[model samples]
Target: MKKNLFIGALTLTAAPIFAQQAVQRPNIIFIMSDDHASQAISAYGHPLSKLAPTPNIDRIAKNGAQFWNNYCANSLSGPSRASILTGKHSHKNGYLANWNKEFDGSQQTLPKILQENGYETAIIGKWHLISEPTGFDHWMILDGQGDYNNPDFITDNDTVQYFGYVTDLITTFTKQWLQTRDRDRPFFLMMHHKAPHRNWVPAERHYNLYEETEFPVPENYFDEYEGRFAAKNQEMNIYRDMYEGHDLKMVTGIDSDTLLFDPWPDAFINTLTPYEKKRFFEAYRSRNNDYYNTDLTEKEIALWKLQRYLQDYLATIKSVDESVGQILDFLEQSGLDENTIVIYTSDQGFYTGEHGWFDKRFMYEESFQMPMVMQFKGEIKPGTQVHGLTQNIDFAPTFLDFCGIKIPEDMQGESFREMVVSGSTPEDWRQSLYYHYYEYPGIHSVRAHYGVKTDRYKLIYFYDEDIWELFDLENDPTEMKNIFGEEGKENITEELKKELSRLQKLYEVPGI
Candidate 1:
C-alpha cells in the first residue's frame, strides 16, 4: 500500500513539469507590409518621415529590438518573401526574379515545420508566392496584388470577394480566425498587408490626412548618375515615366485638362481673340496639368514631386498602421499578447525619390535595406537593438528556434535567438554579406550584379558590363564616390576580391 501511494505522489510531481513544458510554446504572428521602407517609418529617423508616422510599427520597436542592419538577399517582393520562407537565397531557391516563378510548397518552410510540431497555422493576407500555400492548417490569401478596395481572397476551397478596404478586410479575417481557431494549441498567423504598394491608393479615412503639407525631398533626389551607368536608365522616375494607367490612376474623376490635348478645329478657334483665349488654352493644356494647376513655379515643381509622392505613400501607410493597431489590440484582449511573437517588416525597401529612382532591384542601401522589428513578450528582452548582419534568410531558422523545433540541415541561415534572448550579439560573425540583383533591363535598368558588403566597404560586379564598383562606406555614406580602379586602393580592392570569392565558394555558389 505504501509503495502504491509513493508511486502516485511521484506521478503528481512530474505532471506540473510536463504541463509547463507543453504550455511554453509561443504563438507567432508575423506581419509583413508590401513595399514598405525604413525611410517611410519615423522609427528609422528619415528627415522627411514626419509626414506619416507609423506609430503602430514604432510600437513594435518600442516594445522590443529593431534590427539596424537587416537586409534582403534579393530586393523584389516575391523573391524576398521566398527567401524569408525557405531560408535560402534566390539562386538556391530557384526564384531569382518576379517573372513566372512560383514558390514550390513541397520544400521545407516554417509553417510546415510548425504544423509538424503540433501548432495550428493560418495565413491571412497577401501570399504573393505563386503556389498554393502548403502546410498551413487554414489559409485565405489575396490573388496576386489584391485590390485596395473590395479585394478578392482565395481560400482553400474557393475564391471570394470581400467588401471594404483590403487592409481592413485582411485584419477582419485575422481577428475572425483568432476567435475561431482551436484554443488548445498555439497558433502561427501571418497578417500580410498589400497597401503602400504601387499606385499608392489610400483608404477613404486617410485620403485627406497629408493633403495640406508638402513632403521634403531626400538630399540625393536629383542624383546626376555620374559614376553609375545603371542609375541613368531606371523606369521608376516620377517626372519622366509615371503614368495614369494601371496602379497610379486615382478612383476619383480625373480632370479633363490632364487628358492629352486634341487640336481644336480651325474655324472654332479663329473667332476667339488671342489674349482672351490665351489663358483658357494655357489652363487646359496637358503640360500645365502636371501639378493640378497649382502655382508650383520651376523651383516648387522639384519640391512638389516629393510632396505628391509622400501624400499618396503616407496615406496608404496610415491605414496600414491602423490595421496593425487592431491586431495588437486583439492579441491583448484575447490574452495572447504574453505568448505571441509579433514581427513587423517589409518584403524589401523602396526609394522615396532617393537617387532620382523609386523602385527596387539595386544593391544600393535604400533598395537593399529592409525594416525588421520583433517583440516576443517574455522570451526576448525588451528594447534590444541588434547590429548583427541578418538577412531575410535568417527568418525561417529564427521561427523554428522560437518553437523549439529542429532546424533542417539544408537551411542556409542560422537562428539569431541567442542574440535576441540574451541581448548580446556574437563577435566574429559573418565578416561580409553576399548580395545579388538579377532583374536587369526589366523595370529598373540595373544590370545583373552580385556583390559583397563588409562593415566598411562594398564591392559590386556588374556581370553584363564586366565592370566593378567599390565604395568606402565610412568616407561616403551616400555612395557618391567610387574608389574602385582609383590609385592607392589597389591592395584593398584585391583583398576584398579574395574575400568575396571565399564567400561565394563558402555559400556553394557555382563558378565563383
Candidate 2:
C-alpha cells in the first residue's frame, strides 16, 4: 500500500508539491456519524465525556490533529453534509432544509473529483440527501434516517435489507469494499454511521450498558430561557418535547401522553427477530415497569428521563466507537496506516442536555460546534491542537488539496492542510465563522436564524421576528445569558454585526 506515495517533495515537512500523477495520491477514509456532539467525545474535554469515554475516537486526536474551533455552516444533518461534499454553503449546494430537498448530483463534489483523479471512491453508509449519489464508483446508503436494526440499504443496483445492527452492517460493507477494491489506485472511502441519532437504539451487546450509572445533570437543566425569546419557544427540550413511549421507552401506560411517538420504538422493535426481541425486552422491561409503576414528582420524572436518555444515547455511541477501532485496526494490519488519512467527525453537533435540549438547529455553542479529528501519521504531528476556526465547507477543498488535485475556483472554502501539518495556525487563517439555519415552519419549531462568532463574542439574528441576541462567549461559555444590549458592550455588538455582513458578502450570500 505504500507504493502510492507522494509524487514529489520527498520530505513530509508540509503538504507535498505534487504533479498530475495518477499513482501518488494518498487514500482517505472519512468516518462521519449523525449528530454526534463534541461534548460526548472524550478528546474535547467536556466533563460528561469522563462518564462515557470514547477511547477509539480519542486515539485519532492523540495521534494527529484535533480542531477545537470546528463548526458547521448549518447545524442540520443534510445541509451540513451538502456543504461538506461541495465545499460550499447550503444555498449554494441547493439543499437548504431536510424535507422536500434533493441533492443535485450533477454538481461538482469531492467524491466526483477524487474519482476523476485516479482514486477508487466509495461511500457505504448514511446518505440522507434524497438522491442517487453521484461522483462515486460505488455507493450503498441508508433509506432515509435508516432504521437502527435490520436496516435497508439503497445500492446502485437495488435496495437490500441487511439483517444486523445498522452500525455493524455499515462497517461490514465498508471493509468488504476495501477488501475487493481495485488496488492499483488509491481508495477514498466515506464510512458513515447512523448510530447515536434520534430514538437512540444500541446494539445487542451494549443493551445493558450504563444501567446502574447515573449521569450528573447539566447545571443549566432547569434553564428558564430568560431574555432569549427564541430559546423560550423551542420544541426540542428533553423534558418538554421527547415522546413518552418512543423516547423514554416506557411503552405500557394507559394515558395517550404516555404512548410512543409515530415511526419509532414499535417500527424498530417489530423488525427484530423474536430471539433478539426477547433479549432486548429482558434488558429494558424491568426498568420500564419500575418507571411506569412508581410514583414520582415532576422534577423526578424529568431527571429520570434525562438519565435514561443519556444511557441509551451513550450506549449507541459505544458501537460506533468500536466500528472506528475496527477500521483503524484494519488500516494498521493491511499496511495502509502509513498513507491513509483517517478523519472522525459528525454531520453536525447535538445538544446532550445542554440548554435541556436533545436536537440541533440553533446557532448556540452546543449545536453549532462540530468535532473534527484527523490522523495523517507522518504528516500531522501527534497531539496537534488547532485553535483556528474551520468549517464543514473546508472539507472538500482540503481533501482535494491533499490529493494533489486542483480545487475548483468556485469553492467557498479554504484548505487548511499546511496548518494541520505544521501544528500551527497561520496568521492569515479565518478569524471568525458564519452559521445559518433555515428549517423553520419545520421540526423543533426553532426559528430561522443566522449568526456569526469570533473567538470571544457571538451575535445571532432570528429573521422571522426581527430578534437579535448577543453573547460574550469568553465570559459565558455556557451561553446562559444574552447580553445583546447591555451598557459598554455596544461596540462589540456593532463589530460582530459588521463582521457578519462582511462574511455574507464574501460568500455571495444575500444579506438577511
Candidate 3:
C-alpha cells in the first residue's frame, strides 16, 4: 500500500501578537467537508433546496453571515487545500495537482502563523496536502481518499484504525482533542470531514435517508454540450462515466478479469475488519440486489444513477450535519460560543448531475463555487449575508486578520474581516474573481484552463485547446449557451479578457 504520511520538524515563529495584547483572542474552529456542493445545502436555496435541508449548517447562516459568492481558486482537492493553507495560488504554493504532489510544509501556513503568534493550533480530519503537518501542536488525518466506514487515521504517534462511521469518528477525535487542549490560551482547530466524497458511503444509521426521496434532476442533466469543447470532452458525464459497482455502490457481479471495462477498486471495503465488513455489506445487500435486478434505457439509467447518487451523497451529508450540531452544542455548553469564530465550508463545490456531470473541474458555477458560513458571537451581526466574491485563497488571511495579527505580505489574499464586521460590502472590494485549473493528463479529462467570473459575466479560455467561451451569467445562469463570438458580446468579452490579463499579472500567474 502507498503511504501518504509526512513528518517534519516543528518550527515556532515569534509570538508577535501575544506579546502586545492583553485582550482575549478569539477561538476559531474551521469545519470543512470534502466535495460538498452548495446546492446540496438548503442554505444556498438551489433547485434541490426543499427535498434535502441542512438544518445544522443553516444554523450557522441563521446566527451569522452566509457568503453566496464564495469559491475555490482551484476546484481540485489538493490544489484548493494548498491555496487555503498558504494564501497563494497553486503556482506559488507548488501543489498544482492532487496526485504525485505534496505540499511544501516549509512554507508559511495559517496554522503555522497562528502557532507562531501564540495560539494553540491543531488539525484533525482530512489534511490532503501530503506533507508532514507543520506548525500544529497536534495533527491527525486520514490517508488519501479515506474510506467512509471505520477509517484509519494517521497521527503524530502512529496510524490507527478507529471503529465507527468515518464522519462520526472524525467528530469524536475532534471533540476529544478539544476536551484535552490547553484552555488558558485561545486556539485554532481545523475539524475537516471526509464525508460526501466519491463512493458516497453513508453511515448504516443514515443509509435509508432520502431513499424514498426522488431528487429534482438538474435542468441540464442531459446537456448536449453544444458549444463548449471542454464540456464535451470531459469523462465525468453521469450516464457514460460513472462506474456501476463503485460510484453508485451497486454490486455489479461482472468479474473484472472477464469484463472489458476496468473495475472499481474494492480496497476501501477490503480494509474493513470481519465484523465491519459483515454489517456494512449486509446493509447495502438489498439495495445492490435491487439495482442489479433492474434494466433500463440510457435516460432511465441516468435518472436512476442521479437518484442513487443523491441519496447516498446526501445521507453522508446528514451525518456531517449532525456532527456540526454536536460541535455547536459543545461550544455553547462550554461557554466557548461567546468568543469563538465558527466557520462551516467545504474544500470545493461538487456537481450533483449539473451539466450531466458528477465531478468538479469546469469553471462552471456548480463546480467552482463553494458553500461558506461563519458565526462569531457578538462580533458579526446575525442573519447577515455577503454577496462579495471570496475565494479559498482569502481564508488564511482572514483567520490571521481575526486574530489581530499582521497578515504576511507574501500572502496573496486579503482579509474580509472589515466587511464581516460592518455587515456590508467594502467599497473597494474586488469586482471580479480569477480562477485556474491545471491537472490535465489527469482524471476526468478536464483540460487545463483559467477564467474570470464577475457578477454579470464569465469568460474561460481552454488554452490547451485554444478555445474561448463566454457566458452572460445574468441571462444564461445554467451556461447552456456559450456566447463568446456573439455580435453584441464583443465589448463584454474584451472587458473580461482585460480583467483576466490584469489578474494574471497581479497574482503573478502566467499570462494568456
Candidate 4:
C-alpha cells in the first residue's frame, strides 16, 4: 500500500454492518459529469436556468441534501477526480492537471478499501486517469475524452465500441450492472457521464433546442480584464478562442470562411450513419447559414457566439438529466431506493460565458466551486440545504463512513456524512478552504496561483508575477476589483495572508 491503508487509532463506529444478515449495507452510486457547471443546473437557481432547466438533476436535490458551499480543491477534470478517489489534494495525489502522467494506481484508493471491506465495486464511464483502474472489481471506461457518437469503452476483457449517445450508453451500462449485481452483497458503482464538455455537441433529438429563444448575455460578457494580469492574458474568451468549426457547429468551408483550429466534432461525426449525419447537419442548417451570411459588430459577434454556445451546451445536459431520471426510476422500481445512496455532482465546475471565458483553469468562483447533491432516502431529508464548507476530498471518507468502514488515517478529508445527515452545521466545522491551481504557462495561459477562501474574503497570490489580490467577497461578489493596496484593508490582508499560510501548512501543500 502507498500509505496507511487501515485506521489505527480511530475507534470502531458502527461494527462492519455489511456482514449482517437482515441489515445489509447500503449500495452507493456516485454519478458525475465532465465540465458541468452548477449554473447550468436549474436546481442551483442561477440565471442560466431560465432557459436550460434540468428537472431530473433537480430531483436529486429535491429528495436529498444539497451542499450550497461545496468547492473543488482543483478545478480541472483529472485533478479533481484524483482528489475524490484518494481523499487528498492535487499535490499529494500527484495528478495535478489533465496533461499530467497516469495516476498512480498503486496508491491506496477508496474502491480498493471498499472491495477489501466486502463490497462489490465498479466504475463505468470516463476514467481519464491514464492508468488502468486497480481497485474496481469491474470497470469499463472511455478511451480519452470519449466520443459523443459511438464512443469506445475499455472493459476488463477488451476495448469495445458502443454505438449510441455517450450519456445513454453509460447509463445503460450502469443499469445493467445494477440489475445483475449480487443483491446479497453491497455494491459501489460510479456512473460517470461525458456530456457538456468542450466542443459541446447535443444529441440529434435536441439539436434545435433553444434555437428560437435567445439567451441573455452575461453582464460582464465584454470584460476588459481591467486590473488582473491573469484575466487579461487568458486565451479562453468566447470571441477569440472558441473554434469556428469545432465549437460553434459552423464548418469552415461550408459554414464560414475561416480555417478550423480544433474541428473537434469531426472526430466522431463520420461514425454516424449517413441518415444521422444528414439529420445532424439539417438541424444546424439555419444557424450556420445566418452566421455565414451576416456581418455584425465586435460585441454582436460575441453575443452571437454565446447564443450558439449556450444552445448546444445546455442541450447536451438534457440527455444527462434524462439519464438521472432513468436511474432514479430504476432504483425506486427495483426496491433499491430504500437502502441506496445516489449522489449527483460534476468532476468540477466550468465557465458558461462568465467573465467572457470558456475553460476552467482559474481560481475564480465559477470554476472554483462545484455542485453536489445526494439522495440517501432514509438518511437525508428532502430539501435539506447544507451551508457548511466541503470539498471533493471529502468524498472518499464520506463513502467509507456511510458503509461502516474505518477511514484510513492517511486520508486528508473528514467525513461529512454525519454533518449532512444531522441536517445542521457542526460547532467546529472547517472555517476556510485552501485552493491551488498549478497548470500555468500551458493551456488558457492562466497564471499559477493559490489562495484561501473564507465566507467573506478571498486572498490570492499570483506567485509567478509576485502580484497579490484581495477581494472582499461580501462587497465585491463579482471579484471585479483587487483591493490589495487599498486603504483600510491592511488588517484583513494580513489576516488573510496568515490564513493562507496556515491552510498551506495544514493541508501539507508541498512547500512551506
Candidate 5:
C-alpha cells in the first residue's frame, strides 16, 4: 500500500512536466495569390466586394487581424516575393524585376531558417523567381507565367504537367503534400496560386460566371494622365494594351500565329486538352461574336474591355476563394487549427482598371499596396484591424518570431507579432514606407523609380524621366492630381523629401 501511494504521488508530480514537453512550436501556412487586389477582396469593403464576395478569405480577417495599410517594398512580383522570403528589399535581395532576373536561392531565406530550426518547409504553386527553390524539403512550382489550364509543374525530379485549372491543381497538390509530410516536425507550407494574373483565365466551373453582370468602372478609369509624365508614358493602359487575342480570348480571323496584335499565340490555346478547348471556345463564342459585331467608340471599347477583364478576373479569384476554404477545412479536420498560423496575401496588389491600367508596376496605391490578412488560430483576437504601416519585408521576421527563432541580423524588417497580439498600432511603429520599382525599358514602360509614402503624403521620383509626383493621400486618395509643385505644399514636399532621404539611407539603397 505504501509503494502504490508513492507511485501515484510520482505520477502526479510528472503530469505538468509532461504537458509542458508536449507544447510545440506553431505551424505556419502562408497562402499567396498573384496580383490579388485589396479592392477586390470583400474584407476591404470596396464596392465590388459586395458584388463578388470572398467569404473564405474574409474569414481570416474576421478570425484574426486585417492589415488595412499593407504595402509592398517593390510593386513587382519577383521583387516582392524575394522581399517576403529574405526579409530584405530588392537592392539587398537582388531580385529587382520579373524580366531578365532570377532569384539567388542560396541566400538565407525564411524557409531555410525555419528548416534549420527543425521545421519542415514546402512551397507549391506559382514561383516566378525563375530559379529552383532552395531549403524546401518538397517543392513543386509552376513554370513562368504558368498556363491557366492544365499547367506544368516543375518538381524536384520531373516537370510534370497536370490537368484542370491552375488554382484547383495547386490546392490539390498542397493538400496531398500536407498529408504526406513528416508528421513529427512542425511544418511551414507556402501555397501560392497563379490565378487573377494577366490574361485571366477562369476555371470551367466558373467560365460563364458574371455573365450579364456589370461591375462599376473605377472612378479614374478614363484618367487622362495629366501633369504626370510617367503616367502619360506608361504602356499599361487597358484600352490600348489589353489585346483581344491575348487577354479576352478572342482569336483574329486569320490563322497566322505571328499577327502583329495577337498578344498570345494559338499554340498556348492548344495547350488545353481537346475537351477543355471545346469548352473554352464554346464559352467565349458568343462574346467574341458580339465583340466583332458591336460598333463602339474608344471609350466604349475601354469600358467593354474592363467588363470582360473583370469578369474573368473575378471568376478566377472565385476558385482561389474556394481553395482557401478547402485548406481551412483541412486544418480544422486535422486539428491543426488549434496551433497553426494561416496567412493570406498577394505578391502585389493589381490595378483593375485603376488609372486605365491592367498591370502593376507604378508606385501608386492601387499597385503598391498588398492585401494581408492573418489568422493565428487561438493566439490572435478575432475581428482585429491593424492600421499601422506594414510591408512584405516583415513577413520573414514575423514568422521567425512566431517560431521562437532568432531573426538574422542582416534582415531589414521588424516583426509584427506584437501588433497582431495587441490589436492596436505600436507607438514606435514606422511612420513611413519606402518603395522602389526597377524594370524599365521592359514591359509597361513604367520608369524605374523609388518613392516614400507617409500616412498622408506620397512622393515618387521617376528617375528615368527625371520627374517628381507628390500626392496628398487624404485629399486625393485616387491620386488623380500631382501636387509636387503646388502652391501651398512646399513645406510638405520638403518634409517628405527629408523622410525619403532618411529611408534611402536607412535601407542602404544606392543613388538616392
Candidate 6:
C-alpha cells in the first residue's frame, strides 16, 4: 500500500509539468503605418494631439510598453522597413531611396528565421522594398505607394484589385489569413497600412471627421530657416511652394495664371463636383485677379487652400485608426489575444505644418521620431514605459529572440527582449543615437546630413556644404537656434564631433 501511494504522488507531480509542456507557442502580429509621427498619438503627448485621438494606438500603450525614445535608422519608408527586415542599415541593404531600388530577400530576416523555427509567416499590405517577400510563407503586397481606394494587391496567386479602402482591405486579408492558417504551428503576421501618406484619402466612412475642427498650428509652423542653410531649401512647406508635382495628379483650387502648369491630364478634371468645380475655377480666377489682374485678396485664397489640405489629410488618419480597431477586435475574437504580440509603428515621422514643413527626412524632432508600441498580452506587463534608445534595426532581432530563434550573426541589431519582457534595463546602454539622411534636393530640400543626438545636445554635419548645426536640446528643444559656431560652446561641439566620429567608425560608415 505504501508503494502504491508513492507512485500516485509521483503521477500528481508530473501532471502539471506535462500540462506546461503542452502549451502552444505565441503568435506575433506586427503592424506598420506609413509616415506616422510620434506626435500624432495622444500617448506621446503632443500639444496638438487632441485634434485626432488615437485611442486604438493608445490601447496598445495601455496594455503594453510605450517606447518613448524609439528611432529609425534611416527616416524614410523603404530604408527603414528594410532595416527592420534585414537588421541592417540602408548601406547594408542597398535600398536607400524610393525610386528604382530592389531589395534582396536572400539576406537573413526575422520572418525567415521564424519560419525556420517552425513559425508560419505571412505579410499583407505595403511591401515597398523591391523584392518578392522572402521569409514569408504567404504574402499579398501592394505594388508601390498603394492606392488609398480600390488598391491593387499582389498575392501569392496573382495581382488583384480590391475595391475598398486600402487599410480595410489589408485588415480583411489579415483576418482571413488568421482564420485559415495552419492552427497547429505558431504564426508571424505583418499587416502594413498605406494610409496617411501623401494624397491622404480616407474611406467613405471617415470623410467628414474633424471637419468642423481647426487644427492648431505648430509652434514652429512658420519657421524662417534662420541660421540653417539646409532648412531654407526644403520642398515640404504647405503654403508658398507645397504644390503636388505632375506625377501625383493634385487638383488645387487655385487659378492657372497664378499656379504652375498642371502636371495631370484634363481627364482628372472630370472627378470634380459642381461645387468643387466652382471652387477650382474661382481659385484660379482669384489668383489671376489678385496677381495678374488685381481683384481678390491674398488672405481669402490662403484660407481656402488650408481648408482643402486639412480635409484630405485628417480623413486619411481617421481611416487608419479605424483599421487598427478592427485588428484588435480580430485578436480578441480569435482567442489569440492572450498569446499574441502586437506591434504598431511607422516607417518614419511626418510633418503637419511643423516648422512649416509637410514631409520627413530631417533630423528635426518631428521628422526624426517615430511612433512605436508593442503589446505581448499576458507575457509583458501592461502599461510599462521604456525610455531606452531603440532603433528600427532592433526590431528584426527582437522578434527572432522572442520566438526563441537564432538571430543571424550578420544582423547588427541587439534584441530589446530583456527590456520588454523582463523589465530589465541595461547599464551599458547607448548614450547617443546616430542618424543619417541621404535623400537630398529631391523632394524635401533637406541636405545630406549625418548627426549624433545625445540626451542634451544634437550635432549635425552637412557633408556637401561643410556646415555643422548644433542645438542645446535642453535649452532650445525646438531647435530654433544653431550654436555650432557660437562662443563658449566650442568644447561641447568638439566633444560631440568626436563622439559622432567614434560611432561612425564603430558602425563602419564608409564615407564619414
Instruction: Give the clash count for each candidate.
Output: 0, 0, 1, 0, 0, 7
Off by over 4 Å in 5: 1-22, 253-261
**Model 4 segments more than 4 A misplaced:** 1-22, 253-266
State the lDDT of candidate 6 residue by residue for 76-170, as single tens digits: 88888888888887777777766536887887778888887778899999999877899899999997777776667997789997766688888
Compared with the true structure, what per-residue lDDT tens digits does model 5 show for residues 1-512?
99968876776587755334324688999999999998889999998767889999999999899999999998988899999999999999988888845899999999999998888899999889998999899999999878888788998899988877899999999999989987657889999999888778888888898867899899989889899998888899888887776776665643322223554654357677777777777787777667767888877888988998889899999999999999999998999888889999999998988899888988899899999999987779999999899999999999999989999999999899999989888899999999999998888898999999999999999987788999989989999999899899899999999999999999999766
TM-scores vs. true structure, each candidate? 0.88, 0.94, 0.93, 0.94, 0.94, 0.86
lDDT of 2 by residue, 88-189 (tens): 998788888897459999999999989888888899999999998998899999999998999999988998989999999999999999899986678899
Q: What is the C-alpha local distance difference test score of candidate 1?
A: 0.79
- What are the Cα lDDT values of the candidates? 0.79, 0.88, 0.86, 0.86, 0.88, 0.77
Candidates 1 and 2: which is better by lDDT? 2
Query: For model 1, which pairs clash?
Result: none
Task: Score residue 42 of candidate 2 by CA lDDT.
Answer: 90
Residue-level lDDT for 302 in candidate 6: 46
lDDT digits (tens) for residues 173-202 of candidate 4: 999998887655799999889897877878
Q: What is candidate 3's lDDT per residue for 1-512, written digit by digit as tens?
A: 12312211111124435433523689899999999999989988876856888999999999999999999998999998889989999888988888745788998899888988878899999988777789899999998777777778998889998877889988998999989987546899999999889878888888777878989998889898999999999999878888775677666452211112326454456656777657766676665666657787777878998998889899999999999999999999999899899999999999998888998988899889999999998889999898888999999999999988999999999899988878888999999999999999799999999999999899999998999999888889989999999998888988999999999999999544
lDDT at position 192, candidate 4 = 88
